[model samples]
Target chain A: MDHDSYSDAYLKGVLEDVRTIAVVGASDNPLRASHFVMKYLGDKGYTIIPINPGQAGKEILGHRVYAALSDLPEPPDMVDVFRNSDAAAGVVDEAIAAGARVVWLQLGVRNDDAARRAEAAGLRVVMNRCPKIEYQRLFGEIGRIGVNSNIITAKKRPVKPTKKLI
Target chain B: MSEKKSFGFETRAIHAGAAPDPTTGARQTPIYQTTSFVFDDVDEAASLFNLQKVGFIYSRLTNPTVAVLEERIANLEGGIGATATASGHAAQLMALFPLLSPGDEFIASTKLYGGSLNQFANTFPRAFGWKAVFADTDTPANVKAALTEKTKAIFVESLANPGGIVTDLEAIATIARDAGIPLIVDNTLASPYLIRPIEWGATLVVHSTTKFLSGNGTSVGGAVVDSGTFDWSKDGKYPALSGPEPGYHGLKFHETFGNLAYTIHGHAVGLRDLGPSQSPFNAFLTLNGIETLHLRMERHSTNALTVARFLESHPAVEWVSYAGLESSKYHALAQKYLPRGAGGIFTFGIKGGYDAGVKLVESVELFSHLANIGDSRSLIIHPSSTTHRQLDAEGQTAAGAGPEVIRLSIGLESADDIIADLAQALEKAVG
Candidate 1:
């Protein structure tokens, strides 16, 4: 599924097995790009959530609003979407019926038959990518805003995983 | 950060664009010294004045300490973001303000920096009719026979200032990618620690973060970077980045900031209509002088190749331009684009000519007759009596500043006390 080139080890194995995302067309109008990628993925500690069917239950940076990814209270290891590309084909079928295990899509959202029906229901898709610019281009955090997060190396960056995962 | 690594370059130069003070954890980067930014209402100040979000609403178009020295010199020049200005001639007029337009035409490199050939042959053609031409780009076929059709961009200097010329960046980046135009370079004397003009393909890099990425001699500032791989909407010929911005409402900056459209239109319309920002206390002293830019460019390229092999075995010297020497004719394009060295500035000549180059920069006593160049101590000048004393004599020998040159900038000091203070200032200027 070449949704326009990926493989930084399949986007660091779907952003290192996500860790709660949701976002959908989330916004509280902080001049929406899904409210600045949901306040930059809730200021990087993730667990974001938002969703917004018109701010379903209100609240954005403090996470709450949920109108679907089947009104989540639990199931959300990633769904991102930020709708468009025909509402990311029904938010990739409600993120494979609200049990998402990755589906991403955001930066100018794409669909490809809703990413082949969310990889034939086992989820994990990604498409027009932008999990906050791929978790700041895979953890180096967009080189603190000078961009070119085209990953080089010599190690030393890690320390981020705050918590989440069964 | 293994998952197959990435971060190096001295840990992205002491942690790229920094972190820590997300409000008081303040591990350094703080000079935000106010001038606006409070918003949180009026729809976050009309989404930061309709650029539809990307915070900061002032300090001349963004500041958090000059956005961490414009994202630490766009992450030490790999690029894709950067702006920081107010010098290096406002980063070469904000890297030609989103690609010229008043009767466009660009193409520089006549071995630049005599105040960038007097701001491109007299202040960008008398304050913006934007012309520039000049070529001799050390033969990239005289920059594709100085291209025309109102050229639009090519500029160089990946290690040029004061001659030791080296622009041939992948043959003028393959003639600005087969003339689609946009090369830019100026990497202030090879400063992505000795050249990173967007790793040789260059599509804008500019600097002069007051020479050598603020490696001391207190910041004057400047940066441009970008290299978001220019496409600018495939030859629509940069209508200020593929047309539409009649002051943001028509928007369309490369169709909404894809690859951050020319560094977000160089801070929303060239530092918001040319204000030339950069002063969160000189971007916090050029971000602590770029956290020791790789140990001061390896002791300023080993004290400028030991003061260019002591003025090429001086006996009052007569020539020594210094592309890390071996009789430099840009010594194999400085070992294929500055293979880490050839950098603490160069230039020589002497054996008494223009009054022994104004008596060896008024007889140096530990250099510093300066008109400035990546300083840390040693410095000197004399270009036909001080910075190409207003060009002419065929623009000071086609900008190499001839008339018995002299230049030098070598500065992490002690290379045998900078070759015994230029050997007693060449025995009192030509013994």
Candidate 2:
């Protein structure tokens, strides 16, 4: 997100302050981006609250999936908007109503009006970037696809060459 | 792949480590449940006690039935030998204990199970003064970056629990070789049926039989398998194997037992002191669990793919993150490491925000909200609150478990039924 004052550091701060994230629009499809992103983030350490109106009352990642942010047991640190640009505004409205301190839009998902509204309400706004990807990158989790490269392609490790038979 | 004597995994599962009772003609290996074995007169007893004779003198040091399970797993893993332990976590500890000592260190993957993270970050540091540093296990560079002068091992799970992210065993093994240490892989998720870390160059393998190994979850056990690939006597780096042992009256393990000494010491010293021996019942259950390992693992992978696909297509889903999916960044790695199929777990984000997520979980029908994984029945959890709750907010994000994520471990149930259950649950969540 390229908001003038909103920096990656600021987004990181929001991510840092977020003890738990309510992921709206969680999908079950293996091919969908959100499914793995949720698992990735969940694996990293965030308590992911899976939100999908279509899958309400079902558990995802062992947590209850609420239909709306208003139905959660308590206010979460951030309400991650995973819906389309069109549906994002409504989610942000609920996020504001739920007393969430931040609203993050996933990568390729942006709504200026929603960002404006969320920013206007004093909630942190991060648009078009995944917390999972950002976390890995910012925290050095994005090491080179450093497997079997036989060379230190990732993370700048010095690679020793194997001796060839004479 | 060895042509010595081929048998089906089932046949090998039962009879690999055992021999028929010569006197009674019993098919099963008898559980020698005595604490100490009686010797025939003085000479035989002296040889046995002195480690000169290859025989069992005590259950704490060795047991006939436990030995059978260890052998069977060794054969299954294509490893040289194996050691059975009280728990999977204990297996990991024993595997490294012989290679490292106080003031020494090891490099580990950050993607390790939380208990292991706790074991390395807090427990091992406090108890043994042996330090462990964690790097992002997903990337080999991070693991290499974490290495230090005192480091002796690079440890990771073949298929990390909960997330089911398969580690690049060959890559990690290469690093271990370069670092002159062992690559100890916890092969609990894939089991022997799905993938063998040893074949991929892992120096040692460990398992938690409580999970898929004991498929029905009826047992609590662990095993450590030595690939016997690393020669401890090569550079004198390992004193435990090269140096004389006071416990055994200055008998060097490599000189005496050669390839098998590591397993021998795990029993002779590790188990005896730690007293982490598995019970006969749990071992038997795990043995039974092995019978259908191949079948269960296949079904699990198929079901997981189905569930992941369903979550991806749904309007409520913001993204799906199974490596099996073409869109996943880990897809290539999964293809490289887990060619047969990726294991059964993955996570996804929900659409409506936090409250919608709470409703969705409450609406699920068949999926159990539990803290365990690799069960026959599907399991789900929101890690930020449940498993990794102790981690502060920043730690959570660093661990890949940001809030707004839900992890699912698919089960062996029919794929369609599983999807339908999630479907109705999603419908209920949104409505």
Candidate 3:
């Protein structure tokens, strides 16, 4: 699969299938990227399991924070890696070991070798993408904030928002 | 956002920045008439306030309806993002707010809308201490010569307001690029239907959506679009975009938002503090107006050419300055930039000078004697007597609004009726 660009249908399918997400490199600071992604996903009805070694055994967004993916009570449907390109190589192995269905690399974090390895292991791989941004773009939420969602459709969006907007 | 394929201009015009209402399935974009939005809890609210997540928090910073308009304008202009404002002047201020600090300077074309010219030449320099160095951008060399160490951007109208002069965008863009600064184009007159300045390398495009974009003169609004191509981080010149912002806990906009830095800053800082946000209702009206932008521009261009031809041949006319006419000196430049049509507004000199110009505006029955333009109804004005009244004689003449000049914003009226009305008005004024 070309990790560079994913079709809208592919992204929507993945988002629809994933109910639980494990955010690696999650931060407690409100300004950090990982913390906001966790909050947005949690608000959007996703069961977010935040993984941060520094904040392990603590509560983040009302969910118990874990040091690593192995400590989770159950394997998440998606492993969102928020680490740098170098750290992603190690995180990809952990995601495969955790029996996660998908591995997602945050924006500006792309390791082709790691992505290929994850794909060979039968785990779906998406690189240089943010799950939160994809969810908003596909579901017509990003358009509300004046960013080009790039998905043009005349069809009415589902009356029920999958997550909270207000 | 998938990059598989792109939609055509007409399709994008109607559909871009809009989707069926997720809640009610309303096909049209409804005016989200509200002052504020509700947050689920304190965490989400904090996320919004911190710029960690993108969502509506307040009407001053962002609104649903206004956001749709901003997205649509950005889409139309091929920009990465946009911020809509209360008026075109507000848009100009927003465009310059991030790039210029106190004592910083930018170069602007002398040939511009009288209000914009005044804003740059008088108001901004006096009020904000941001100096605008006026240059005759028709000759691209003049733009290059005016640049100084303090210059942060080059500003020009794609198609000049009253004179119908076409700036050499690509040439000026190259100069701006060499200087490591952005080129700002006011695309108010030449709507995207006629020309998109970004395609020719404009880093930012501003619009008075009050004009052609709104098409009927019903709403007063403006927009600043970021092409998202310029690198704000290179020289450390634009600190507002490249450096850490104080208000958002030292958040570096270009680092945080990438291509969307300027637009986000325009809303987060410019609109929030200046309080020049576009009203939700005005945005809705402008949205509806833009749906038929392609159609109206086609008719407006054709009708304007017809009127320009008639005025060019009339014995009572001194000279016609419409770029659509082959007789115009700027005709070749117009063909290069605005091939669709030369837009709907142009200036001409009447035989009897100032009195003749004043009489013609008064004598026209079909044309509204008003200060506004881009209306569906024909409109006329004597700039020397009204719009350019504050400028000195030399200033007025240099801006292509001499004492003899009469400007007409040709509307989507029948070509024959428009010509006949001008003919009768000319005869009465000169006879």
Name the candidate that leads on lDDT: 3
Compose the digit string of candidate 3's lDDT tens values, residues A32-123: 66776887788788999999999999988788899999888788899999899999999999999999999999887999999888889988
In model 2, the runs with Cα more than 4 Å from the true position are A1-166, B1-11, B28-36, B352-362, B429-431
Top-scoring candidate (DockQ) = 3
User: How well does model 3 score by local distance difference test?
Assistant: 0.89
TM-score for all models, in order of appearance = 0.37, 0.68, 0.92
For candidate 2, the TM-score is 0.68
- Order of candidates by TM-score, top first? 3, 2, 1
Point out the higher-scoring one by lDDT: 1 or 2. 1
True contacts kept of each: 0.17, 0.00, 0.54
Query: What's the residue-level lDDT of B414 in candidate 3?
Result: 91
Steric clashes per prediction: 3, 99, 1
Could you give candidate 1's per-residue lDDT for residues B272-380 as a string of tens digits?
8988888899878878878888888889888888878878887889888888888888899899988888788888888878988888788888788978888788888
Task: Give the higher-TM-score candidate: 1 or 2.
Answer: 2
Question: How displaced is residue B227 in candidate 2, in Å?
Answer: 0.3
Models, CA RMSD each: 18.8, 30.2, 2.8
Error of 1 at B375 (Å): 15
